[model samples]
Target: MDFRRTSTALTREQKLAVVSVADVKAQERITNSYEDALIGQYIEAAYDYLAGPDGWLGRCCLLEETFEAYIPNPGGGFELPIRPVVDLSSITGFEVSDGAGGYDPVSAALYAKSVNEGFGYILHSGQSSWPISIGVDPRRYKVTFKAGFGAADDVPSPIKLGIIMLASHFYQNREATFSDNRITAVSRQIEFGLRNLCGRYRISRDHS
Candidate 1:
């Protein structure tokens, strides 16, 4: 299966920012608002670094987001690529009818989702199997779903704290490796602390 993000919390005001600008300011002990914009960028960068498929954790963060997963050929069911899936919006099976691509929506009654821990799996409701694709299309089946830990309040404290610390680090260090003509390494303590805080939530995947 392959996954692509279709929408994000940024699209909705209420779902934006797992950690706010004020949160980062407080973490860095900033008492003014002069660098609020830059701090906000760092906050977003920290979030991108720790969340999503390419993130360190390889998982969704707080707030709801939509993703689309494509399956070449489905069996009785398949796992949704993103973790902590909140809802399966729709599943559509693709076909080549009259030499043209066609999409048929699977009935909600014919399937169900099973969420355990943060993993999500879609299963056929009964003994039936999923419809087969007619051709060799790579994206034969499309699954749209919402995934995340939920609202800001539902996010774990460790993850939130980790973001704050990471953003603060970015705020203090403008360069990736050098400052004042001298090489600088990222703080090992902060790196280890982030790993410790987010390690349990990291998703290990063997597939591309």
Candidate 2:
């Protein structure tokens, strides 16, 4: 099984800020906007560190995003790589004829989607199974879908708070490491706190 993001045009607007600049300032107890720009950078950095497939959470947080999954000779059913699937756009099976690839769109009536825990699965609608591929193409089966928690407001409070905490930590500590050893302990504490808040939502690599 192979899974990859099909949509490459994710706009900055769609990558919604999990926490606002005002939110970060409030967390850090900043009175003025003297360093608002720097704080904003911290917010973006924090968001990047904790969101999407490459982030610590290994899951989309702010909004739904499209992804494509491929399965070779899928059986009765197969799991969707991304969790909490918002929608299943389409499913296609590849057919080989005379040493050429042909498209075979799986009809909606032949399959159904079910969410178990956070994982999404494409199951046969009735007792029937998925069509088998004729060749050795790895991309025999294709599934396109969108997955995410929804919008910024739909994101869990703990995740929002975690982003704020991380950004605040970045603001407080300008340098990666201070000469004083005490700051290291503080950084570790903050790291652990962020993990505790966002850990449960993190998707395990094994799931991928």
- Which residue pairs in candidate 1 have backbone atoms (N, alpha carbon, C) closer than 3 angstroms, thus clashing? none
lDDT against the true structure, each candidate: 0.70, 0.71
**Which parts of model 1 are misplaced by more than 4 Å?**
8-16, 87-99, 107-110, 178-185, 206-208
lDDT of 2 by residue, 140-184 (tens): 767777777776777789888888898888888777656657877
Stretches of candidate 2 above 4 Å error?
8-16, 87-102, 125-129, 178-180
| TM-score of every model versus the real structure | 0.80, 0.81
Top model by lDDT, which number?
2
The alpha-carbon deviation from the true structure for residue 117 of candidate 1, after best TM-score superposition, in angstroms, is 1.0
